[model samples]
Target: MTFVHAGHGATMLFMLLLLLGAGAVGAAVLSRRVIGLRILDYPTGRSAHARPVPKGGGLAILVVFVTGVPLAQMIWHHTPTLADKTLLAATAWLGLFSWRDDMHPMPALWKLGAQVLAALLVAWGSLGILPHDGTAWGMLLGRSLWLVVLCNVLNFMDGLDGLAAGCTLLACVVTAILCLHAGAGVDTWGTALVMAVAIAGFLPFNFPNARLFMGDVGSQCCGLVLGALGLHMANLPPLAHGWALMPLMLSGLLADVGVTLLRRTMLRRPLLQAHREHIYQMAHRGGMQPATITVLAWAATLCGAGAACALAGGVIGLPAAAGGVLALQLAWAVVVIRRVRHTPGLRW
Candidate 1:
């Protein structure tokens, strides 16, 4: 299960710096050009912002990652397999539809269908390398659905400035570390590093205050890359059967999205419809500052990452880390719910 080490540390660092520069310049330019391009997201009843903002800033991330990672792979002399190539390709595939959606909204079905196809592409590529056992087809269907769900998970959570981007940046960093510890392929860690910096390049335009939103374009691309990397790690020999660590690392995000979706379904609300009932939204409505909420979310994600690493290292059992991650998120959820309930006009 040894993957040929891709490149020297110094070389990878140089490549990342180039990507960071490209992403920053690209995002800055896109932020300015989006207005001229007329790709603006107006305030909606479900929106957290009060004013219209230029959207599709994620195009910078899309372009930077779609162009940079493969080139890095080639330079490092690590020829990516068909699955690896497809994972990267699928990001651009989905980006096209999402970029268009940001400019002109489309039916939910259209976007969902696009996401499914992107997910299927990754799954199909993965199946080539995966064990051809009785469960292979099941894995294909399951992984495909997982990728689509993850795409929407990030999309669903992309409300406040810096939240989705910040959380994703941290997740990529954490996943990269785990990949290194487990000796996963360079394609896994390399993709993770590229994604983190790419988002880092975009973060300045997004966080503390947002001049540009990643919109569906940026968020969905983040989801696809993150999800695909998680699957890649799971199928690696060292991390095989420890797939739970992937989700554990993303506990805060999954909790927020999972709980929100469940509440909506229980209340008979439309699942696909956008709303501000997410726990982060509740905290915001309950007077939490966006920066504060985003930082708090980052902290929770770090805690989950710590637990995941502990589990991967056998410092803690899976059940303990799983329960700990869930408990931490549950505590945060309770705080948000109570704050919303205590607010004079707010409801949870």
Candidate 2:
């Protein structure tokens, strides 16, 4: 599983293979450890799986990320900046806490506090990633809020097998393409490529029928990195409409998570408590196959991401692209809600 890019040459391909091999093999070994230790996510009323499955499989992603990234970045054109280093450090802190939570569930406040701290660390050292014109205070606070939102939204959407990873895989590829078009630093696009392939390594065991789950460990990491990278690109001078387009490109996730959160909030549902009220969860309970749900999510994500790239690249006007993508997502929401509305254990 090697992909040769135009200028980056064999380095990118080699690193991709390195990460893929590490992620796949490491995930397999972690699965055995989880099984032996009885670290399993058993089926609950809100769960997407039917049986107990290995839960800490995301340890493999963590290993591949920390080890492969340093070696891969050496091959990339740009060296790691202060912001990059800071982001990685923050991520390490996050993973430590998340891994603990994966083993023994933590309080919601603790998780939120840790996530906010990580987001703030990136904001503090993110001169390269933030806009140069803004006041430092505004840059730190505003971007921190945005990244925090992204982290939580992304985490909320990671409910089913291949759903979160597939959506993120498509979004990452699109983001990499856009960063390339805008001449973003290699640190940016390189991270995107590595993250995509790393997830590719983990997808096989988790998708279709779950043999292992990325659990809290992988979901939090995915959320944090995607949030950080997206905000970094949104600050690029040439990437007009990027801030708006980022959310829309992830409309499948934003719509489902956002709407569900809003719905739950209005109904005074225990926000901290987990439940199977997301449209995907409802649809799964309504008898939709996991594969079909995953495919639809990926399709909608790709469509939105493509439309966003067109808008960012000036291939299409903002009005046209936004209208098309929004309408498509709106229609998607309608269809999903209509199909799953009748399912038990799901309240709108």
Candidate 3:
């Protein structure tokens, strides 16, 4: 149940730096005015921006991941496995659909269908990677659903600049740390670091100021990869109790997306219909700066990560960490609701 020791710290460090440096350069090139003109995001009634901007900056991250991972495998003297190819292929499939959607808006049902198909691919691929439990069918269904939900959750939370991307970057970094602590192989932790730097490549243009947007292409890819990695970790025998790692790390995103969708359903609002009603969106509408809101979300995620790490270290049991996470989310919801209470036209 243990992993090959992740030796060659120097080599790992070089790989990380190479990915980051390349990603940053790619992001810079993609941010050029001529390049951005290829796909523009025009402001709508529900949009946070006031003008059209270049979108699809997430292409840099996608490119970095697609190339960086294989190179890392080579550097580590590990052969590329079928599972690795499956993961990349599925991500590319979903990314293609998302790219098309960003360039020319597609129907909600169609996008959802694409996401489901990609999720199924991931589930099927996981069967080979994860150790067999008796309930294979159950695992397949659950993993597929997990990927789909995360894909949509991140897509929903991508309303403001840097919100989704920044949060995901944080999750990747923390997940890598947790993976190392749990004695996971270099494949697990190293890939997580690659994802983190990939996102870091895109953040400079999207955060604080909106020079470019990641579009659906970047957001959905981030979600799918995150979901896949979380499932992989959960199936690791040594990390059996680490099942809650991702949820705890992404508590802010899950809480915001979960509550918003539930409230919409209760109010008879169309579930897939786009709107600016998320807690973060509501806070922004209430005059809070996007940077401030995103930072708050980052802080919540960091808190959750700390608690989750405690569970990983056996310092606290799963129940204790899970309870603390729930309490933290509830407190966050309360504070956000109170802050935006007086914002006109907000139902909650």
Compare the candidates by TM-score and give the number of the best one: 1
Clashing pairs in 2: none
Q: Whole-model Cα lDDT per candidate?
A: 0.84, 0.76, 0.81
Residue 294: error of model 2 in Å?
Answer: 1.2
- Report the C-alpha lDDT of model 2 over 1-348, residue by residue, as the tens digit: 244355467756666566556655665565556556668788887787778887766666666666656666775655778877877887777877888998998889999999899888877767555455558678788878877777787678777888887787778778888898898876777677667766776787778877777777777777777877777677777887877667767877877888888889999888888878887777777788889988998998988888888888778988887788778877867876777677666545
* Evaluation by TM-score, superior candidate among 2 and 3: 3
Error of 1 at 158 (Å): 0.3
RMSD of each: 3.4, 4.1, 3.6
lDDT of 2 at 10: 70
Query: Which lDDT tens digits does candidate 3 get at residues 1-348?
Result: 123344466666677677657765765665564244767888899999998888987777777777777776776677766657777888889888888898889999999999999998888887775536658878788889999999988888888888899989988988888788777765677778777888887788888887888888899999998998887778766664767888888888998889988899999999877888898898888888889988888888888888878876778988888788779778867877887777676655
TM-score of 3: 0.91
- Across 1-348, the per-residue lDDT of candidate 1 in tens digits comes to 123334466676676567656655765675666646666788988888999888898888888788778866775678889888898889999998999898889999999999999999998897876647768878888999989989999998899999889989998998888888888766888788778877887888888998889999999999998889878777766663467766887889999999989999999999977788899999999999999999998898899888878887778888899899989998998898788888998877
Residue 180 miss distance in model 2 (angstroms): 2.0
Q: Give residue 80's error in model 2 in angstroms.
A: 1.7
Q: Candidate 1 clashing pairs?
A: none
For every model shown, what is its TM-score relative to the native structure? 0.92, 0.88, 0.91
